[model samples]
Target: MENKTPIIALVDDDKVFQLTASRTIKAAQLTDKILQFENGEDALVFLKNHASDSETLPDYIFLDINMPYVDGWMFLEDYSLFKTKLSKPIEIYMVSSSIDPRDVDRARNNENVRQYIIKPVTREKFIELLGKAAA
Candidate 1:
């Protein structure tokens, strides 16, 4: 078997969060490839287009709950429909600023979501999550 660097996707509408999180991931040296999407729709399209391409498919996705279009829940709904077609398994983490219990509980209930993370994820946390995925 060959070791392959994991690819990460950041799906969020917040530009600041995207920039900061990407920088943090880079600083942690988690992955050299990072995909950015402004909303779930875009992420979904990307995933669909690359469903059979393991090299292009992301190993992990950091999803935001709120966005202009296709929020995290909506994304998960659609993703579940076609996830089996994907060439590789992708771990999804719900990363949101909303600390609402309802939001957390809803995400936790979703089968596709591996974890629900609060906003402003620390570099160490990113390392831990990505490291686990890579492992």
Candidate 2:
């Protein structure tokens, strides 16, 4: 049998965070395919375009709350509308720097969001999240 690696998407406006997180994810060796999006709008477009292509869709998404074009909340709102059309289930984790209770509550309440993870996720956390997704 061939081994299928999980694809991960990092949707955030922070270039530094994207670079650091990508490095951490790479070090974990959970997957080699990492997609980067500067905002939720681009990520949403990608998801929509690949809705029927499981091979091209990401298995996991790390979404940031604040962004220029489209925020995480907005992305989730749009995503919920067409989630059922996706060929494969995508686990979305709301990774934000915001510590506001409202933000946490909102993310936790979203059915599409797998979990709300705080920003600057450690290498161990990346492994844990990716391992869970891979499994």
Clash pairs for candidate 2 = none
Q: By TM-score, how accurate is candidate 1?
A: 0.97
Task: Give TM-scores for every candidate, taking all chains together and pairing residue i with residue i.
Answer: 0.97, 0.95
The lDDT for every candidate, in the order shown, is 0.94, 0.92
lDDT of 2: 0.92
Instruction: Please give the RMSD of candidate 1 to the true structure.
Output: 0.8
Off by over 4 Å in 2: 1-3
Determine the backbone clash count of candidate 1. Answer: 0
lDDT for 131 in candidate 1 is 80
Which pairs of residues clash in candidate 1, taking residues 3 or more apart in a chain or in different chains?
Answer: none
User: lDDT at 119 for candidate 1?
Assistant: 85
Q: Which ten residues in a row have the lowest lDDT in candidate 1?
A: 126-135
